[model samples]
Target: MDDKKVKILLGKRIKQLRQSFNFTQFVLGEKIDINQRQVAQIESGHSFPSLSTLVKLAKVYNCEIKDLFNYNHLEKEEKVKENIINIISNLDKKDAQLLYAIVKVIREK
Candidate 1:
């Protein structure tokens, strides 16, 4: 998969996991020292997170680093992809393109 796809998938997983743990954006963001808006941005797949931030998130969620990016079941993968697409579909074209560009860069690396 491409980087954009990765970002979106990561975001979807993060959001779902966060919700599963009954965490609001403010609650999760506080642990990482970011505002709720930032958390929302990350969960919405509008922005990528730094490594340290990702570590903190994984720690807070009680999940391994690999868990944050993994989709083992085909149904789960499709659901997350659908969620990511839904989130991005509402954004303006520029924002969507920016996300896609990030994914492209990641894919190249």
Candidate 2:
């Protein structure tokens, strides 16, 4: 992906993680030792965090730096579907059945 796209995806992933932890931008900023406006800028894709800031963010989120970039869910739908199909095609029969059951349960919810 291009730099801009990557930044946007990273921003989305950060926002997702922050929300999952029930943190507001102000709260997340405090935890990461940044100001609320800085957190807003980062989450809006208007600014990129420095390496040190990334480390602080990872620490606050209780995840590795790599997890901050795990934005596969932000990819194009067609690409996501292709990836899912490829993964499913490679799964063993038992794993496939397990995956099917999990998906069914998720759908029922």
Best by lDDT: 2
Strongest candidate by TM-score: 2
What are the runs in model 1 whose C-alpha is more than 4 Å off? 74-109
- Write the residue-wise lDDT of candidate 2 on 1-109 in tens digits: 7988887888888988899999999999988889999988988888899999999988887789998998877776548789999999999999999999999999999
| Candidate RMSDs in order | 13.2, 7.9
* Candidate 1 residue lDDT tens string, 4-95: 77777788888888888998999989988888998888887788899999899889988888888874563476888899989998989899
Q: How far does residue 32 in candidate 2 sit from its true spot (Å)?
A: 0.8
lDDT of each: 0.85, 0.89
Where does candidate 1 have its weakest 10-residue lDDT segment? Answer: 68-77
Candidate 2 — which residues are off by over 4 angstroms? 77-109
